[model samples]
Target chain A: MHNAHNAKSILHKISRAFLILIAFTATFTAMILSPMLSVNVNAYTEKKVYDYGDLLTDREESRIEEQLRKASENCGHDIIVYTVKSLGGNSVSEYSQRAADGINTDSDGSGILYLVSINDREYDIYAFGEMYERIMSDRELNRLADDLRSYLSEGDYYGAFSEFGKRVEKAALNNEDYSGNISVRLTLSFSTLIVSAFIALIIVFCMKQGMKTTRPEITAGNYVKNGSFKVTVSRDVYLYTSVSRVRIQSNNNGHRSGGGHHSGGRSSGGHHSGGHRSGGHSRGRF
Target chain B: MTTSFKCACCGADLRYSPGSGSLKCEYCGTEFEAEAVEAMAEAAESDAAGENINWQHANPQTMENDGSTCTYSCSSCGAQITGDRTLAASFCPYCGNTVVMSDRLEGMLRPDYIIPFKVEKDAAVAKFKEFCKGKPLLPSGFLSSGRIDSVEGLYVPYWLFDAGVKGRVRFRAERVHTRREGDYNVTRTQHFMLYREGVMDFEHVPVDGTSKLGAEVTEAVEPFDMHGAAPFAKAYLSGFLADRYDVPQETCRPRADERIRQSITSALANTCRGYTGVRPQQQFISVANGKIAYALLPMWLMTVNYNGKSYTFAMNGQTGKFVGELPISWAKFWGFFAGITAALTVILTLLMNYFG
Candidate 1:
């Protein structure tokens, strides 16, 4: 009976060890196959570049596709170029954010989207997730927009997209050298003028007030009519209400804003100055 | 002619002490009510009214050999005093005594109201000293060279005008409201037409008319408590000198009118309330009728010649409000400008570098 009990205990220990081995093998196998499954799904589904506006010719599309794919792979970021014939009654911002959500289905929202609305003549650079904050400074972005959009305006679509890819990649990688650029100089000069003017006014006012002994009362608030303030004629006529709109040119294409009522389309390209400043200093170190 | 107020309790001399709002004996520190002193005196109150302005022509003076042109003696110290046409006994420069040289002043034009000195000479000196303290650019010698010793109290002549006015004012005002609709921020500004018509009664708007006193000094010393003015008494002039009006009432009337017109227009414009901005488009003020009275307001005036430049400073003998022009140092101004500008710019640059 003692021999039989010891044998039974040993068999039970062997079975437990074999079960542990099987569980480990199954986890390892799933880990190995999961990435392959996602890659295959993404290969068939995810779009790297989009030419919805149909502005690019087939050869131009292929070239842009090649540049964007390299930039995206090199930076570990989903860099994309999307164009649409119209915003489809949606703001460029809404469309771009949606496009970013669609294109980055398999990844975290860490990428930049260059979206163009052809008929609106507007283009926006929208950065998502952590990479959004790491993008170039607004001043630097202004410089970029001001510099590269000339090619876009002249209809050199390939040249413009190509230049945009290189510069955006250069900034995202924190390798830009703006120390010799005129943007930095313009910033310092303009800041000095504005700050100097304000300080000069304060000093001038203090000196003037110091020298001046008397300022006659501006208003006879002392002798205001009885009962403080009384308005017997309280009529605010509904004089026809007119609405005026200003078409903002967010792309820096030298398009002057015209006064007219607009449809529901608003450009989502707000100022990127606050984030761009950090991007610029990152630029400085490199 | 010189007049003096003596303290009833101490039998010592009394001068109008500004801070106490009474005639105060400097030696015994006893205060006496100004109106009480005026009433106890023998001369009866003559109901001095605004219509009591009497104009006179002046006689030309000859320069004296001793540099004492017009002879006016200090009644208390027996010192010889001389000044221009408005010359009254200032303190005896030698004895440091307050003496009112009261001759030919009352006969020319008796002031209907006197806002006696509510601020003392020491207070005026203190105010002047305070004004000189912060001005590092001022020539050091200007303060140490007894420049402030020239400050003295005098009753400046002003004509008080009372009037009932009819004011009609028109204003253009705007009210703006903004709303966000889809992509557009719609701003609607409503323009308004406002009119105000009313009657306002203004009392005791004093306009200085003394030829010896500049408008610069007098206006700076303004806003005396006209309500505190006791009826003018010669007894109040006992230890203090008063300036007789050198400019006629008619000449001063235009200034008073201008002041009242501005005041009424502002008052009426303010009555059109509840607008983002209200601007006076048109104003019409008509004085239904006005009354004018000659009065004396207190002021301490000093004009110092420092570095061959005259710098004028005045203190309100009623309110201790000090006003003066100080010498400017361009070097100091630029030094501060450079330092502050550089400091602020550095801070701004660092902030922009971090989060521009």
Candidate 2:
């Protein structure tokens, strides 16, 4: 009976140790699996500039894709240029938000997508990921749009796309000198001068009016008997407050780390923010 | 201390001294208070009345007639001076001017009221410089102290009109309220109509009674103190050039009526306050029982010719309000514009560089 009891005890101890080893192995495997999964985070979408609407010729499209590929590799962030015949009845915001959710980045990082809708006559620029504010500020995006204004208006699609790629590359690099846009700088400088001159001219006109001291008295205020001024009629009526609301516009050019810095700042859980992460703003024709 | 303004000690011309507020001899500097002069004047009038004297209003023949009124001619300045025969001006009071007035007094009707010059010549000279002080383009030494001090005092003829005015006006007003809710802002306004009615009494509104002195130049010197007015006395014209009405009261009536209408309308508008927009929708001001009188108000006139164009400066005798035109310097104007533009450009460029 003693020999049988020792065998039972030894078997029980071996089973408990076996369960403990299994739990330890599973925890260790998960730690390694998490990092390995991060490696595939950006593998879902390698096509940086998708011409799904076939807006460009095959050769032009290939050339743009090559440039975007270089830009993406150099900037360490995805750069996308998309064109669509229709927005599938979605507003630009809604459509771009959906597209951003569907496309995941290589490193699960920040990215910018410029889209053109041929039928809707509308274009939108969206910045996605945790570093949306860092990727490009609203003012920078507006400036980028302005640079494309002439090309878009003239229907020079290839020129506009090429310029867009160059500007995005420059912005991603955070170039400090020349800003790659002398025309915009020159226009802003010249307008400032014109507006300042107009304001100065108005000041001079007011000064001239001051020199002209003689003015016809318009009110009887001076002549009214001191204690005699009476309103005689006072009535106020209530009117309904009609409300109108518009989406908030951002003009803050806040400090951003562009694209790569936010990876460490973000959570490792990596389920995507609310399943619709976006801090992008846009201006459109339609 | 005769009926006329004459030197009691040296037989020199005695004029009212503004600094001492007395009549002083120009030659001997003998001072006599205005009260003493008033007393002597009354005594002289009583003496004349006791003799049962009667004076006629007519042009004196040859100006040598020893009558109540006579004329003096300045061969140097060509000025025609008309005053009491006993008060023969020692020097042309309107003299020292290169430009002379030589017209003869055909039949001068005496003025009913005269405002003695309250501000002295020295004070007027200082005020004139104050007017030119801020004009950047004014030529240096153009209006020297000596030149401005020589400005001659003149009894300017004016038609004083008195009237009772009634004005009625209508105004549209608004009250505004603003409210904010969520991302929306709303402004609401209430409209109202207001009526104002008032009656005001305007004692003395003056119209220039001289053709030689244009209306614009004469009206520039305004608001003479009628309170200090003494009866028009020929003795008061000792050191000043006095004129009679060249333009009739009938001709100056319309101007007085227009001023009265404007004054009442403005006066009524003041009573309708606390409105968002108190605009005069309609105004009807009428002058009633208007009385017009001929009077002489004191003024100082100075004309300086520069670059073939003459600029006239008029100063109110009582208030010393100076009015004149400022000559613009093209060089200064263009320089100011360029300087401002360049400075603003530099600042803007620096700001853009720092901000960009």
Q: Give the TM-score of candidate 2.
A: 0.48
Which window of 10 residues has the lowest lDDT sum in candidate 2 chain A?
A: A234-243
Mind giving the per-residue lDDT tens digits that candidate 2 earns over B167-261? 55545556666666555555655544455656676665678777656565667566566667777766676666666565676776766656665
Q: Measure candidate 1: CA RMSD.
A: 29.4
Candidate 1 per-residue lDDT, tens place, B1-356, comes to 22344444455754443333345457766444544444222111111211222223222222123222243555653543333335444444323445454333223245678887777888878887888777644544456666566576666778877766666555657778887666667777665545565667767777786665566667656667667788866555544444556678788776766676677667666666678788765555556556777787777776664444556677777788887776654444554454445445545544554574
The per-residue C-alpha lDDT of model 1 at residue A67 equals 84
A1-286 per-residue lDDT for model 1 (tens digits) = 8557545654664465455545543553354334433421122124556998988999989988888887766555667788888888876666776676666654434566777778887776666543443454445555766676777788777787788788877776663332233356456645754695578558755754675574444333343334534333333222122345544334657767873222222333544322221111111100
Report the TM-score for the A-chain of model 2.
0.49
User: Which sections of candidate 2 miss by over 4 Å?
Assistant: A1-180, A195-286, B1-98, B101-103, B139-150, B172-193, B212-217, B351-356
Native-referenced Cα lDDT, model 1: 0.58
Ten-residue region with minimum lDDT total, candidate 2 chain B: B51-60
CA displacement after TM-score superposition, residue B344 of candidate 1 (Å): 4.1
Interface RMSD of each: 27.0, 30.3
Q: Extract clashing residue pairs from model 2.
A: A42-A105, A42-A106, A220-B266, A220-B267
DockQ of each: 0.07, 0.03
Model 1, residue A283: displacement in angstroms? 29
